[model samples]
Target: MNQWSGVNALCYYLAYILEIYLGFSQSIALILASVAFTQYAVFSWPPYFYIDRIGRRRTVIWSSVGCAACMAIIAGCLLNSSYTTSAVAVAFMFLFLDCFTMGILPVSWSYSAEVQPLRVRNKATAVGVFSHWMSNFVVVMVTPIGLNSIGGNYFWIWAIICASFVPLTYFFGVETSGRSLEQIDQMFFEHPRWLMGVEADCTKVVKQTAEDEEMRHKAYAKYDGFDQKEKHVEVVHHEEAK
Candidate 1:
């Protein structure tokens, strides 16, 4: 999800795109690229507050929609090949950064870690990070060649990839928000379907079971503490009476 989104392509190549493809002056391209990155950094924070509240599945799905639209618009503007369209393309590029930061940027790593079983979580997260960097390398290497050859048409490829994530996520993605690791593990165990949309009931049952178990443990601990306090008080009274 992270690799194919074309974010690295844009990040590594934005100056190149602005100066080479869009015909901006070198200094102007550098400035614009820096500003875009600043926007990327600033926009990354807002999702932190909302991602869990909105839920992972919906966040990624809707963010992909916005990303796809931005990519398509940027592609279209580049294809038009005029000063006015170039300006519009620059605006959409900023918007694209906003969309990516809000959705995939925050959710991907956490979601990957959350979905793994406890035993293999460390290894699994490492593998996922490794895969992400490898894919990043591939995209970064391919992007300049793609731009040189395909021109504006190159971003349409990203647009399609972004659009495809919506359905792919909806069909296969589990709702990880508010679910404990145990609940998630049990959900996969019980359902085991390629399509996870029907796992709601199973997840609820697992969650309820976990809650009951937790309450039982708390109750036991409370009673144990009470008994210890009573024993201490009785020991003090016996000592005083003597």
Candidate 2:
């Protein structure tokens, strides 16, 4: 999620950098930025439908790799400092944003929420959200400083981070795409690190159970007065029968 935040924060300043640093005209930079936005919106979803089909872990890892490669290309262009390289860098930035939207944006929340146990899921989600926002804040605050101090080479730091995330995800990422929350809990309990092969079983029963429990809790909390009234009515009926 920090990677998601960081990359997104960088994108806000990219047009300015392209215009000033890369010597692009304002109109050209605006066009590139608009194209980037279109790419972002277009690719942000549809991959989510395949999260189960393609497997979440693989999707995330490969997406990280793709982003890393894009970053590397962009960094290379900046390092070389030519008009051609600048154009290539602009293209790579669009590609990087596409990869981020497709892979990281969709799964970031679902993956975090799904991995947590039911009892603490809400708390976990809150923490996840906080962390995500915090990451965004830090990236937004630091990016300008980094850009000023280090110039285009600042992207190399993100590229390395993206590359590192790939292995970290592969080794630690649990397969929870097709499993029930209960199954996910059990898998974490038993293995805690990995799952084996071809597991896309639907989670209908588990989903129903969770929903029913949630409804029961809500109903009980809302109807304490009704419960007391029913009890009093039963007592009166018993007295009348006596």
Candidate 3:
């Protein structure tokens, strides 16, 4: 996020300088840009097409590439001396930014619902969400200071972070598209860092949750009041004739 948003920061800083240089109404341009962004909101859920078809790993990988491309293009345009170069760069950068909602990172909660087993899935998801938001909080607080201090070279800095995630995804990310808990467990068992604190037994933990969910469902069905009540029939006992 730091690097991804760093591109936007670059656009803003560049836009500020460009506005002063161009002497055209930048405030109006900014307003127009915001309106252009509304188009993205208008056609919401473009990722809905691929989230189920391509799976989380592919979606994340593709979006990671997108963030990289967006930053790189912005950097290239800014590096040029011509004002036209910078303007085109800003336009393209904003276009890409608007489309970022279609990225896999935003739809992760949906992925968790599709992937995790039921019993302890809620617990696992809660922990995962906690870690994600905690990291987001830390990154958002620190990023502005980092970008301001670094100056123009910060675009490259953001590029490096986005680039780093691609390899990490390739090496560590599993294909959870159509796979079940047991398959996910196999993926985890292959890598211990995946589970955190529990080490080797985390695979077992995943499997146990799957089993628990299955057992709970069966138990609930067995005890369903309407069906069970019907199952019970009154039996009259006749005393032996004396």
Q: What is the C-alpha lDDT of each candidate?
A: 0.88, 0.76, 0.56
TM-score for all predictions? 0.84, 0.78, 0.61
lDDT of 2 at 150: 84
Give one digit per residue, the lDDT tens place, for model 2 in 76-143. Answer: 78877788998898888888888887787777868898988999999999999998888887888888
Kindly give the stretch of ten consecutive residues in candidate 1 with the minimal lDDT sum.
201-210
Steric collisions counted per model: 0, 0, 0
Q: Give lDDT: candidate 3, residue 41.
A: 69
Candidate 1, 12-36: lDDT as tens digits: 9999899987889999999999999
lDDT of 3 at 116: 62
* Tens digits of lDDT, candidate 3, 1-242: 42243434443444453453333368855665565556546534677666656656556667767777776666666555366875676565665564355664454556565456666788888977786667666555655665457533456666666666666555655556545566666655566575232333321222234576688668778879657666553222222332
lDDT of 1 at 119: 97
TM-score winner between 2 and 3, please give it. Answer: 2
Write the candidate numbers in order of decreasing TM-score.
1, 2, 3
